[model samples]
Target: MKIEHPAPMQWQFSRRAEQLQSSVIREILKVTMRPEITSFAGGLPSPATFPVERMREAFDAVLSRQGSVALQYGPSDGYAPLREWVADHLSTDGVRILPEQVLMTSGSQQALDLLAKVLIDQGSKVLVETPSYLGALQAFSVYEPEFVSVPTDDGGLLPETVAPIAQGARLLYALPNFQNPTGRTLSVERRLALVETCARLGLPLIEDDPYGALSYRGEPLPKMLGMNPHGVIYMGSFSKVLTPGIRLGYVVAPVPLVRKLEQAKQAADLHTSQLTQMVVHEVVKDGFLTQHIPTIRALYADRCQVMLSAMDEFFPKSATWTRPEGGMFIWVTLPKHIDSMKLLEEAIAQHVAFVPGTSFYANVPETNTLRLSFVTVPPERIRDGVEKLGRLIAAKA
Candidate 1:
């Protein structure tokens, strides 16, 4: 009684769609979701630091005061007061941030995507660190840019080597403060040199700094943008200190670039959420971050210390890891013979997990390296996980 039709054929797709690949960390996170596993895989902020009651108060206040406007459509650039707040917060003695130069985004990730849209063309050369943020690599790859990985050390990006590799490059993407996966902060001198060199070379610098505010030490370093405002696009986010749920971040750049980014943003999502922006503004209008950020610093420092001590006691002498002053991760380089990807299989069997270093690179990867996140796991659990991981490595070695 039913009419038969020809079988459906495979849908044709663009070449760009064919090149899209899944994030390795995202795939690893699925296995780590089990309660039994002690996961050091995700770059997630500790939930204990989230100001739940304060955010609730802000939401209620927004609804009570500007309910109609908060729910309606807004400008592609962002809400004015929120943009002004971002500008004021970032301005320093020598550097002045104009509100017109600030563009609010859904998150710092959206800023990366927007920059890629405006700056990258097919086969355009883009410079990056030898090992960089996986999320940035994923976002930039969609644009089909030819990536050139510049060598890095504990001090962060090498300014001297930059000039040689950066020729014919569209931009150099860097996370100078509390860098993801590495947890290293660039020295003030190096930052100044890098900024100066980039300015001279006419290469744009995109500074993605989400974890800069989470420094364990009370002191903060001068931003690279402060050195060369016209040459750099600085990105910041409310995700680390507050909560990622609100999905709030902003980019400060020169007026001309901001105009192009706004156009790209218009096509992306029209605008970031108006309600979220208004609520975040209400929550932090009276300088809430000034008090809130220090507490996060203290908590993370204690957790980091716990993980460091555990590594010292349990791990072998041959295994080396970075001792970060502040930030969420610890990079461990195991013995030359061991591959972290294979080690992860054993670690998961023993109910522990970490991100392999291979996922953070643009091209050839170091299989012996891995990244450990200390903030989310409790002290006792961290001790347990590190000990188990050390024993596995010791056996393999």
Candidate 2:
């Protein structure tokens, strides 16, 4: 122990690992964990949403029936039956996909990681929404790509605005339905335009949709993959509908890219958990999702209504936020000179927590912006939480 190598062996480390950005949600979670605090910070599904009781039953059944397979190392591509189940569940209208197209992941987060590994080189140009998923930004940042933010509005990303920017980008990443942080969904017409434009520009699209199944308003829009299978990597997750604790998600990409992602997954994590896949396959086998998902949607819809009502009643006239139809988060922008990060200390003193919005951006950040999550808390607490945030703002004024 006393003997040390000359110069301490120079302390080897990868340059890529140094550039990774920590998630703002995590920091906010720490602040919210105090017993006095009410968290509107994490993009979490409600504990009420987790079908934990049934999943215990499902897990037991899976373990009993396929004990060896459940515990053993498995193929990187994913469990065949689980892939088949996902493809079948995604099938709608006249569109369909085969199981061969699916690649299971630890979570959709892993899909973002694999995409970054396969597609990005240092200094590659990447396009993202002005207010994007912080997790996606963090995952992709490790590769050290130059990023550009495309402007967005309540209608979601402006297709025309991004088309010009797409001219030089290697990949265009978006969370089209109930987008994280902003809570804006793209119009169907705009979604088609995005697919077509990206195809024309040769910029592969990573269409991240963890919230699509949770949408509580309007008829479902056809997915980008359903429209143009060859051009988009459509990522899906069970975390929103089932339970996030299981960490099951998947991606469907074109054959060539799917192979590359599979290899990358093997290199990165060997494979996603087979036990979880077996559990998921067992749960989905008997049409449990048909009964399960609607419960999540209805509960979230009621929570969303509670948030809107609370915002209307309590927020300052100078503050404005999105009126989202579905999903966990709502984006808020304060009057100029108000910094959400700075306000967070006072907000925590008031026992309410929300994420500062700068964390979502690829470049320049808006000091006025913030993100709030309504999915995890009770409807009454959402009312109380937003009211407290309003009081916090008024005190600053």
Candidate 3:
């Protein structure tokens, strides 16, 4: 006798699941995987800069010297020596950081998610730059907070304008050094004022500085965390300098907040990979990045110049773009009549690609803006891709 089977149950998802959306940059990267496309859509560091030989040596050393410890389960907070290194690395003459305040994350991206889980609630007000980092917006969206866009210019976020709208905000997130989408750096004067303003108002500030060390001039800027360590939460990463495959990044915060984040992280992933942490500590323990980072600065600076020159020669007179002192991206603003989203379709057809500015916004988006990454592409290819994009914009303008 044949038995009748019941229909499969429809899955019920939480309200948080409803807020999920795929990353537009990651989606565009799929199309650019073809060898014929000269793509500037991903924020990937140049593979030429990765320390492959050093990493292989470090992995071999870790497994040979301390195989059991390297492979065993470690503390939820992180490896001890790595935490101490992060503390000492970030400490300055004006401010001191303790090892107890550091928490290791899978990457800085995971740190963003941990912060959202610890700080955000339904309808909590969060402030961000007018066109903020897309990853941050995506991470915070899952927690269901209301985002308010703060006005900005080439100099970066306006300090005076922050106080008026910051009344009920939970936190003010800013990338004061070589921001992600715009590559704009906040001036030292503005940094002081913004930190003082937040400190006076009793509001917390989140300082994300993944690109701070990439300055072309080799001059480092003062971080806001040094100004008010108790009030600001600082996030840093090794992805830009080392390789991203190891997936190592860190957070330095007040000890109390660090403990809270550690608890949240435990509930999420229990702990980061033990073997990866040991290998990274082994690689960076002896001042490897001191010599390595300058080479990256020089290479990126050269590529940036090549792309800028190509844009000047090829783009229409109505088009304008930022001349970044450092970092991988240059933000472009086309004529008001042109929409970069539509322009991207025409561009991909011509074997060139870029990220549209719409995904970078928290609320309202500027359709005429787009971001171009120059580090992964060679200098000659940079010129060709920029020229192709320029022709597309000129036709629309």
Candidate 4:
């Protein structure tokens, strides 16, 4: 028996598994979780804005009324009523979305995965804005596509520059309203031009709008999905407005693509949680978000202003940052010599943390940049964190 021992077997993973890397922001968040840390690293919505009472009531009602159905497995596409609700909610005067076109997922992040799975082949040319959402990049990279970073300015992705590089591209992804890392909203003029350009080139566009509803003013800009319903795939999430814990997000695309995504989703998870879909539908079906979203906007607006003011007062004159009208993030650019990855190490020693901009880029990363999220932190803590970061930058500069 002693001579019959076998050696340990080594597991072989696929090539795609090797390409996957841990999210830098997520890793930083683990360090920031310490109570002493004043973290602006996560794009987490303020817990104060969560509809605790309403969510409680909704969950109770669902359990009391339709407990069996809520607990049972749901359609792969999603709960029927919730799909209808999303379709109706997103429908505009010019663009009418049918219930058939909606596919609810665990979150928009899952939608990104499904889209990549369906649309991307090996070496597929996928287009993304320079410094696009890190989550999107992480999702897309799993499929091993060739990511082409399109140029962007303050207003967001450049439309004119798109077509030239757009040749042979599988799809163009953009966050037209309040982008994640930069918080730069695409202008209406550029939005129109971008849609038209994509249409002319027969390129598909992925419109990810998690923070669109968080606009400081009550008004959100027109969605690209409204411009070219058939050509664009729109992804929206309740994570920013409602609580992220339940994990509900959706996609509105052409019926054909919706079917394909549904098939992919079925293969992945079969469906998003039946209870979560029903509970959220019960909450949002009767115009709850109409009143609720405004509260979030106001709180985030105040916090954003506080952070901006602190940056002005504390940050060095050599530093520059985005002035976001809405959303949780502000992208900061320090002097070119300063690497934000190293700066984050110094910041953690001072009990503060942020996501370095290098993770946000698909191709050439700008190491001098970093993203700050203001919503979760208190105003005083926001100021303290910004001041500490400022002092650090001043020393480096």
Candidate 5:
């Protein structure tokens, strides 16, 4: 067989695509899919919560009733009924949004991608919650924005730190409730302060709330969108409550931004899946989410207590971890001498693994930190995993 010679024509590509790298966690998951690895590394939810049998019903119904539309290409705007459903549900947050404002994304992660496409240009300034969602970081990175982190305390983001920085920033990506990594909810005081500060500065805010409904403790604080709807782009997902495999998520951006986001969506693969939208719509219409979410909360609450108790029993005094009220993750800060990336190698060697904190930061990672998730494993594995992690720390000490 003879190979065809290349057409030696000069070609160029978007500077952004040339700089991008595939997700690290996605690659790691392929290895962890093996039965032997007790992976604490993944952000996966518990399989017990995935309504596989119900999904089979959804698939059958969609095919039997709405086969062509379900399988064929959809409008760039997304399925209308599902958009209306999301808009109606969002009304509970005191947000007055129409179905037109909602863009169905493959997941909230893709919503981040669309926003980055619309908002970020080279050297554009982006600010994030310190140790914010790593997927958000990866999505925003393709545009090569200059990222700056704001310090957060137990109650979440410190507004005094953020007020001055909002000065000429293009975007503020906030995971205010039950934030990933830390699992801390922004206090009502900080939320209000953040809202006021950002709105005053005319900065575009991206409010990512994939973990809001999963809270097991504390009173719900008013959403940032409620405080100032005009300036915030709110991102939400069914990945936690319903199922992630469906890839259903949406973003409610403020008016002007919403228009551009739709154009960006057109370029980024047309739209989110129509069949998945119909399935989610069917389940949501049946009131399963309202009933299903509380069970998830209960299971996670019980698991959180078990993990916290295990942390108290096993973790060394030199190490400290966040006690998150609601959310899937807990961040741990190890002793200064411990580089989490180095320690992850040790952890994986013991048949246990976790994401190193280095990957989460936009600038330099606080090498002593790492995130541990409590929702994926059964409580017994969390206990055993924490014990193993503890033993490794002791050995290193």
Candidate 6:
């Protein structure tokens, strides 16, 4: 048999393909993978916190007890026992969540993608927080939604910001607890006001809470989903608490919306991996997270303090940053004369790297801002990295 070779033809791409943009943070993270770099670029959880032994045991137990089910395909809605566990875990005093409302996803990233697939359309208005999660922006942008970023403070998005933008918006996406890029948590008072305002405005809220479990104080605030169950769509993940390798995340929304998301998910990847789902359920169903999570909290808290102290001692007076109670990151604002992207080049040359905040903006980016993740770097290295970054900033200033 002879195979004939044909001339290469020009490929035409869709408008959506033209709209697709690369993740700037991820691009920088690739450069930081070198062993010599002390990186604060990626929002990576500490490897020391993974429950390796427990996961191994869970894998063994699942293989021994229900090998066939573990390896077989699962419902797009998710594993029943896992869904029940999610509902029970997130259900609070007055807010009742049912297992049917929970849909398991490959990760929170997939949840964002699925939500965008179902909820977003061409030229749809999507509200986002100023300096929001870059991944969310990337996921939503592919659908060609007009992103409007609401102004934020240390307490997160202001309620007043929602009123003007809420009229024709499809959804308001926010990270209320230890927000990514900027480690600001939404205040309890602000949460109440924002939820009330959105409810009154008839705007849907997409609350992404991947880092809620990592709070150092272990004091959880009122969730928007709990406040206005009908209006808020909640997303949660085990990536931070357990491990990212399993790639498990879940979403709790109104049933009708969940059904639509299920359909979208079915087309995407059929369902999340059954083996990982069963293994995770086996690991957490035993109440292991109760004791295990506190250890992670303590470790992260210590690391956060180290980074803060280092910043205080080494950074210039013109350089300001957030003091977070929990989560993996700290947001910094350098002098107006300095650009974070330029600083990153110099920092990487000095064996240090961080993500510039330009990528997080949906519009009108502030170039002087940057994000530094503290959880993965050790105290001594964090001190050195901060010092090097500070020196670079001072020189630029």
Q: Which stretches of model 2 miss by more than 4 angstroms?
A: 1-12
lDDT of each: 0.93, 0.87, 0.94, 0.93, 0.83, 0.92
Candidate 6 residues 1-397, lDDT tens each? 8758977888899988987878888788899999999999989889999999999999999999999999999889999999999999988889889999999999999999999999999999999999899999999999999999899987789988789777799999999999998999999888889899988988889999999888889986778889988999999999999999889999999999999999999999999999999999999997999999999999999999999998999899998999998888999998898988888888898999999999999999999999999889889999999899888888877
What range of 10 consecutive residues in model 4 has the weakest lDDT sum?
A: 1-10
Candidate 2 lDDT over residue span 258-361, tens digit each:
89999999999999999999898888799997788888889888989899889999998889999877788889999888999999988888888999998888
Q: After superposition, how far is residue 31 of candidate 3 from its true place, in Å?
A: 0.6
Model 3: worst 10 consecutive residues (lDDT sum): 1-10
Stretches off by above 4 angstroms in model 1 are 1-6
**Model 3, backbone clash pairs (residues 3+ apart or across chains), number:** 0
TM-scores of the models, in the order given: 0.98, 0.95, 0.98, 0.98, 0.94, 0.98
TM-score of 6: 0.98
**Candidate 2: C-alpha lDDT:** 0.87
The better candidate by lDDT, 1 or 5, is 1
Off by over 4 Å in 4: 1-6
- lDDT for model 5: 0.83
lDDT of 5 by residue, 121-225 (tens): 878999998878888988889888899898877777788898777666889998998887788888888888888888888887788999888878534567888
Off by more than 4 A, model 3:
1-6
lDDT tens digits, residues 116-176, model 3? 9999998999999988999999999999999999999988899999999999899999999
lDDT per residue, candidate 4, 1-397, as tens digits?
A: 4756678888899887877799998888899889999999998888999999999999999999999999998899999999999999999888789999999999899999999999999899999999999999999998889999999998889999998898899999999888989999999999999999999999999999999998998889999999999899999999999999999999999998999999999999999999999999999999999999999999999999999999999999999999998899999999999999999999999999999999999999999999999999999999999999999999988
Cα TM-score of candidate 2: 0.95
